[model samples]
Target chain A: MVEPVTIAVDVMGGDLGPDVVLDGALQALRADSALHLALVGPADVVEPFAAAHDRTRAVAATEVIAMGEHPAAAVRAKKDSSIVVGCRLVKEGQAQGFFSAGSTGACLAAATLVVGRVKGVKRPALGQVLPAYARPCLLIDVGANADCKPEYLVQFAQMGVVYMESIMGVSAPRVGLLNIGSEDTKGDEFAQKAHQLLAASVPQFAGNCEGGNLMAGDFDVVVCDGFTGNVCLKTIEGTAKTLFKYVKDALMASLPSKLGALLVKGDLSRLKGKLSPETYGGTPLLGVKGAVIVGHGSSNATAVANGIAVAATTVRANVAGVIADTVARAGSATPGGEGEAAASDAR
Target chain B: MVEPVTIAVDVMGGDLGPDVVLDGALQALRADSALHLALVGPADVVEPFAAAHDRTRAVAATEVIAMGEHPAAAVRAKKDSSIVVGCRLVKEGQAQGFFSAGSTGACLAAATLVVGRVKGVKRPALGQVLPAYARPCLLIDVGANADCKPEYLVQFAQMGVVYMESIMGVSAPRVGLLNIGSEDTKGDEFAQKAHQLLAASVPQFAGNCEGGNLMAGDFDVVVCDGFTGNVCLKTIEGTAKTLFKYVKDALMASLPSKLGALLVKGDLSRLKGKLSPETYGGTPLLGVKGAVIVGHGSSNATAVANGIAVAATTVRANVAGVIADTVARAGSATPGGEGEAAASDAR
Candidate 1:
């Protein structure tokens, strides 16, 4: 029999508070018999849910980090906060992974500081699976390092490949560097330097992928600096929401359109389900020592449950360890270390 | 009586070549009695169309700059290219503005190097009017300066204000710095520093605007470095296209859905029209001494006609002169000149 992977859930985090998180955790526990959850929050908040589930346990924490608080400072000061405590559980080997729909900054801070970075990894990246034309594409460094060096992108690409292959079940994922244009000479100095390094090193490198081509799903993995990636991600999200709203408004403008809307409502719902953030569960903070899944702050119960499932799956695949191994191998293959060489060249 | 505004149209440029451009130019001339076009291209290609319209005249240009060629090199080597000649018409006071549905880089290079930058303006920005929820918002520096100094953003805001107030007719346009977060301290060094400068100098500074809030039309002007703006613009384009395609596919999945689609065809057409790039005509290359408009290479007759109309409107408003005046006032108001001070501080 396979051993159950214990995943720590931050019940006190997220906009919905502990109640929604606890309910979601219970749902996740019921769905997977081989999964275990440690619901971390105030004793009174987590007890009822923990007592009802056979594979669930309660881990009490005293404080909660506000979404607007400075991440590192809050994590350092509030050692008993759900986010910090949950990450600590993973660090202590009590849990294989951590899941939170909390303050993204806080989760990133606690995960990097408490659970720690994988050995030989320069910077951890936030990898998100987005719906595209042909298949789902994984975008790395969505908001980890806004200012990035060329070597950092190289490592991001490696981590992305590992995650996509192991978790998403894609073989030899095609990697692309997101830029303003398809030409290698496009973009800023940083992008130019990164392109050269990626072309030289990353075997699956597909050259420059323009922003307009991202949803075409021509490549499996797209790497970009956190700033551009964040803008792109949010732009897509905003555009999708706005477009749907526009379409709905148009559909309801007249009787004929209203009847049409009623008839096609099911198909619309299916499209929405496919495009929903919950479908992808959460973005993984790859290259961390343990599995760290950060869900949308406005995530519902389904999203939370999906996030926990993602955490469990990532833990089972040992994504962090694989990333470390990949980085080490790449570093050894290049003389004087790829990171050092890129840094020197940049200087 | 108001005198006609003479505009130079690059008849040889664009994907469809001279025929489509001339057809569009003739249409613009027919629509507006107070508009005259100097059709700049090979004499043989433009003469037939030019002779057909009372307000149209042909100017001979011997060479054409390909879209894929390097901008600066091509402009230097092909001095008699249609793009260069069109801008030269504006420079020689033969035309009040120049329009091209050709290579963006070439137009930018020719406009900056030939027509020249307004006095005290450090960088000329590409300003695009995007349809937003409340109103059309102007996004500046879409792909001009990939690597930007904080002061350049300040100038961009000033230019945006001028364009919005003079052209878009927005009274005291609110300008927002585009960043990952809305916080004052959010984003990278450039964004944070630019936010500070903008807040200090720009009268209508609306603080930081996140990417998701862009389509909401909360701010009149959204400013960012060229790279992020380019990514955001293209991502929107790609996402919109993908979503529409998905909707179409869903509608065609079954007979019932197809019937519903037929009923709501008008509504769908309206939605598509609102989101179409052709609706905006072209993006104005702001801060150039003379009006220079760059349209999409795939522009149709309607889009080309709209581009010509936009050029005429901008020329009548004297956007470049107003921008120069605004910059001069801002520069004089600051003790050490905001640009120099910000540049030194950034260094």
Candidate 2:
């Protein structure tokens, strides 16, 4: 049998530390046969997992940045920090990619600063897959770059298009710019200018999309600046949390409603399955030199495995290469090219 | 007792028409003693409600607007349209204000064209009270003017602040520009230009606010163009709907979780009360000469009652007058007041 590809795991990442991180990594290993792991963190953090299960599945790359430390400072000071060490393994070619459930800020800093950007990417973006009605719609720049030029969004659109196609198997995904309305003049100054820039510079735009259409699956890929996308994503998450309480209260307030809720429970679960943040467990930091999947900090065992699988799938799909290749082909539409893409979208 | 002020209600509005509208009107009368409703529609629609309920509290202002008719075109064409008839009552001092659960486009058109804007008010805005952990937060220009000028957002800030202080009882509500980020220079051209104008003109802007802080209770009044606000509002609504499904599935996943849900059901309901769309039911179309509360077409009786209460509260608190007075005092700032607020921010 061929030797399995080793993936680097940021063992010190996440709020619950090694317990949740270790639980997730172990579960991930069980789910995938061809994957081995380089678990990077303090010895104490990595040793317990090594003692419990198959030591053959993971090798410790010990040391870590404290959760409270500045991400950039930590990366510089803590040379062996879990996030740094994990990304370093990929940089050194010992591992294909890395997965982390830690400080999104620090993780992003290390990923770009260490692993670098793809060949012609103008700016890297944190691309997320939202579980909409028809299929998972990918929204890029969830919270990486706050300031976005029209050209940056165009680059993000191209990169997001490639990631969705290669990793998710979506072909010729319709690209849409997230805006207040679908009309050309309906957005802020940037959107209006971006519309002009996109139509003239980029060929993939499916036109403008409203926020209400997120669930309606209006397009395959939704492109926006990180600030707007992050706000949109988190606002949705907050609203979902808020609405869950309301619907439950409505159902339980009366006997008839409760009975109806019970009858429809299976349908409800199926609907939930279609929308769970866990089903698509990780958001890929696209346009990076290497694959970096940012898993939810609150993720459990199943989610962690899913995140690792996502990173591996991205690596396997050669997403970064395709992204670099696509932008290179796009040419002058992207002026700064790979160098601009590498640094502009960092935390 | 002195006669209650009449509120002209459009019975022909909304998907359910007179039945739900009448139900909501009756609910409103029962909840508030000062409510005198002038229910407007054809005799067929209003006569039934008058027959079943005490006519002393409700009067039929007979007229009807066809659903498919154009709002502005219909208001001018169909002089007998209920929405127009209702606005006429407010114009003639037969009613203090108006409320409609009809076509949003129709309601705003009727209110603006019929009642008109306050003197020197170049633009009017729809200010919505978004439920928050603290008192409800106000966001102006939800969908009033699709296109916004920098001067218009500044005007909205002044009006939104008055609405918050008067109706929500927030004293000196921290006003903020809803931008992609907190930086003064961040966001699109309009936002950047508006930042300069707001700093120059408006008095209480707390500085630039990122989209993520919309719920964090940082600003009492968050101002953005209609397009961005609509997108942000819809995104929040969509996300809430999505999360609502996830929680239901989690609670019903197994027997123990279901049992746990039982104990926590009351707490869940209380939480729902804070987040429900009904808590802050109506959005006041600010800058109008008279009070006008626009309830959503999907609103239930509770939401309708809350809308009535909100209109009554704004009028009662003299919200519009406060805005008129504030602008008068700050009128000496400059032609556009673009640099006045900026000078203050610089301090």
Candidate 3:
């Protein structure tokens, strides 16, 4: 018997509007027998769908936070916004998790402020799975803390280790510090210090991994400050787009090549599907007290449903609880009794 | 008649050995009638070739700095090393420029210490062209200085502007700060301060460019701290390799796809040729007093020849002198009298 997991779905979020999210909600409900969804959006938008669905209900949210508005400001001002309402559901214990494909900033702000942070966790980081070769690698702090202390990275690594083990099903995740070179003395002051802390804290630390190894599937988890991680993630996205464009141009250049393109079109499309974010569902907001999955703003129906599934899986795995414990252990084990040690002491 | 250009080549520098560099030297000598080569290496490796070829001479250096050796230490310890000898040629005005496929760190160290810095330049940066869509974009400080001041970035932009205009023939190149976000307020303290300096110092500043925009060919020049720039460069390289592997796998999955792959093989090869680093030749050691072109360690004969051509072009354009003037002008135009302005004042 599977334990039932209820997740709040922000239908008013993604770029495709309510219809796509609603469609995805239905798909998710059909796929998971023990999954329940609280469709969060304007009353008129979600009311009918909730009434029709068996295990789903409507959660009224009056306002919508646009993608362009300021994240913290918009989140604060739009009290009845779907992102805020979805987070509130998790905080109120009405939903075990929250999923949104909205503005990342708004989602992050609402989740952090409303849902709160896990005990012993200094900062909640965004851990995203890079669609790498052979297997995917999880990159933490994709865009949470622009400036991170060494202790914060240690916390991130602890959370990442738990997330990878519980949700990703890896026996023991290999952690690598994202840096310019593999050597400990290779980068700026921040990197050198971070390297020392990570080596001391993470038992599975695989030294430093360069940017080129991010998609090489050599390590299970790669940790870096949000700024570097964000740039790295976006660079991969941009590079993929640019390369595919080049491939398309090459295939369309001559008559024989066009025939070749037609023949291999289906296989290439399937390859794209495997590498797409929709396949991974969403990025988990680790170190948060509740299960929060933030999808891409451009997510479609399949992606939304995948996000819900990921949220449910995260909820079932008790990722937040595990992260809390892991962080406590790491904090206690840290040398010099820094901020992280103080956090553990408070707990 | 074209003015003669003399470039000292580090014959024993690359992974492919002196034979490859000698072959490239011969090819370059044949291609450009006015081009002269001063092959710097062990006597046995370069002497016979130089004796046989017209407009070519051997400058023997007994020692060879291995790629794995510490950059500054090797340069300081081995006075008669090929890299040191090559730089000495340019310093003594025996050669207009220096070209090498040796260790980047060693090349940078020798160039900065021996060849010297252009007046008013605080730090000499390594700027490489990213093979982007439609055209290429110049990325400065790829791996020269791990940490950079705001004024250093301004200097990088100024040097980038001169390189793009003179070599790439991009009139009034658009400069962009490689940051996590497009917003001015986004990123850490370093980025924020750099943004302010770039906007004020560079008239052609295009605001902040995210990592995704790197290979989009949207901006002609993107500047960042050496740490960030190095990671960005390697990540792109890694992502390209990963994507191509996926493409290859997809093409080999089935019989139909295999046939398609066969048909498109030639066109794809040509496309790869256009995108390869060989096309760009080498990364210029910008801000240095003399022309220094650092080729890839794995560079073959063709790549070596291309590097020599780029060095010849750099010497002809007097890129270092232009950068000096540009830096002085920018320093004078700056709002506050910082280190850059102090440099200009000293000049």
Candidate 4:
């Protein structure tokens, strides 16, 4: 085994606070002995759960981030809050990465403002790696920055390709722009411009993948503006839920269906595994200084464990450094190089 | 059963020409005795399909509309083209409606330019019913007009609810503005203004439904600017395909999984039936003065058949006349009320 990679966990995040978070962290550590964590939250909140099991030197604590407050304000105001403090540890190099099931907007802000944007990175995209046939395909900008320029999308494509190749071990991943139709003349000015920039600038252009091809798994990485990506991601989630509901209703609608359901229960769970976002666990906030894994709001122990695993994997892969270098190269021809060039200023 | 609605079909308008269209029209006619069709196509090309099948007396003929040519250019040049000819029949009351499994853009232009927009409708919108658990949720302005003001979305919401209530017979249909989040402040300028406008203007303002809720059976109808709506609609299509691929892959991953798939095949097919866009088949161009249905380019016999069925249903429901009357009422409140003045002005 390699050196144990330490992660900072937000014990006060989610509907089930310290109990679930502590339990999940402990479970994760058990599953992967190389895992170590800094459980950030109120000492009193985390103490009971920590004491219930053997209090190992491997675990640490800070303070909790409240759920009720505004994300941008809370991260700045309560620097000692679990999510904030936890993120700070990674920033200071005390922890290899940070994992939080807290408010997504807060996590995004803290990571960008505190961890900082990597050099030449225009936008810190939130990349969701969903299950694809054989290997997973990365869908970038799920709900990060809503408005994006063509260059940002190009960078996202490059960043995404790098993540898939380095982290997922998929070489020469086919990158596609998400659009209404697969035709060249489709989409708005931004989509059209992004297509031009990507085809001209990026090395691997998988042509254009229509929304239908996205689910068909014709490409390895699907890139789009945060707004479209978020919409696409959420629509998939909605459709899946609708499909599942219909399946349930159908099974209960008839006696034969009930028998079939019982017989196929195990298979159904496995099928669910294929569809579960938790199976992939966390999303990496790309183009940040330090590793940050964002888990789903309703994420359970397995997903939480996987989130820590992903963070560890990302650290080992040195994703941030690679992203910085990639961005540096891509923007070298343009004005202020990659570093110190304001992201908003570039577009 | 319901006074079989007579619909005029542009048989030669689709990509596959009259062969698939002929197969589909025959199926629909056989299935419904009340339906009569004006089959418009190249008389020469259509004869073979007409000869092969036991011909129905309801089928009439018009000349051809090529698939590869510019939609508007082709229609304009070939005034006797199948699509134009079919709509002309409806215009002259030869057939009560028109359906084309052809170029969507062409059909839209034809409806607006030829048949004309319904009186007082701001813009002619496309209403495509997406599969949901309860039934299907209607999404307006899927790709009709790329750029739209807030008022367009408002009108779409109003008209879409009426379309569902009167035609699909959903009473007090929940109208949702397509938005990024449920929060009032979560969208672009158009969506923001639309949120406020819808709240005051529409009686059953169901607040907002995010992309994920589009097919979650949360709302009966969803409204948005054409640009965003098109993007969102495509996103839904793409995400669903991605999920479909994942599920199929999981089922075929190994022998055990394959065995599970065999056992649950029935349930799986049923799930697919519930979500497949093919089940809904054709999308109706909602604000036309006469009925005009546009099916998918890749539509096979089922979709084409459904397109015919939709055309028949739409005419029976008198969707355009209802919208025209509704728009007249809505328009008369503020203006000189030359019928369709605002609609004509908006266009």
Tens digit per residue, CA lDDT, model 3, B1-347: 86799999999878999999988888888889999999999898888888888999999999999988889999999999999999999999999999999999999999999999998888899999999998889999899998666678888998998999999999979999988888888877668878888887789998999998999999999998888888899999899889889999999999999999999987888888887777898999999977999999989999999999989999999998899898887777875525533221110
How much of the true A–B contact set does each candidate keep? 0.68, 0.24, 0.78, 0.45
Tens digits of per-residue lDDT, candidate 4, B1-347, equal: 57866687777656675678878898898888888766677666556655664433234444455555666787687677677777777777788788888778778777777888887776889888988767678999898876555667767877788778866779889999887788877765446666876786677788988888888888988987665677677767666665666556656766666665566667667777656666776887888877788987777787889888878877777888888777676664522323222221221
Given candidate 2, what's the lDDT at residue A39?
79
> Which portions of model 4 miss their true places by more than 4 Å?
A1-4, A31-34, A47-69, A334-347, B1-5, B13-20, B27-34, B45-70, B231-271, B298-302, B331-347
| A190-285 per-residue lDDT for model 4 (tens digits) | 577668778877788877877666666678888987766777778877877776676667656656666656655566678877678888868889
Model 2, first chain, TM-score of: 0.89
Count the clashes in each prediction: 0, 17, 0, 9
Best candidate (score: lDDT): 3
- Residue B22's C-alpha lDDT in candidate 2? 78
TM-score of chain B of each: 0.96, 0.89, 0.96, 0.88
Off by over 4 Å in 1: A1-3, A334-347, B334-347
Q: Judged by DockQ cut-offs, is candidate 2 incorrect, acceptable, medium or high?
A: incorrect
Specify the poorest-scoring 10-residue window by lDDT in model 4 chain B.
Answer: B338-347
* Docking class for candidate 3: medium
Q: Provide the fnat value for model 2, as a fraction from 0 to 1.
A: 0.24
Model 3 misplaced stretches (Cα beyond 4 Å)? A340-347, B340-347
Model 2 C-alpha lDDT per residue in residues B71-150, reported as the tens digit of each score: 67878877777788888887888877888867666777877888877765767788878865445678778877755666
Q: Tens-digit lDDT track for model 2 on A1-347?
A: 43466678887777666778777877877877877777777776666666766633344555666555666777877676788888888999988889998877688889888998887665688988997755779988887775566568888888888887888888888988888667676566567666776776667787888887875577888888776787678766655543544565666866655665665556556665556567797888988877899887777767788898888777777888888788878875544432242221221
| lDDT tens per residue, model 1, A1-347 | 65589999999767886778877887798788999999999999888777876988999999999999999999999999999999999999999999999998899999999999999988898988999987999998889887666778888999999999988899989999998888988877778888887887789898898889899888899999887788788888888888888888889988999999888878887998889877888999998988999999988888899999999989889898888889988986743345353332220
Indicate whether candidate 2 or candidate 4 has the larger DockQ. Answer: 4
RMSD of each: 2.0, 6.5, 3.3, 4.5
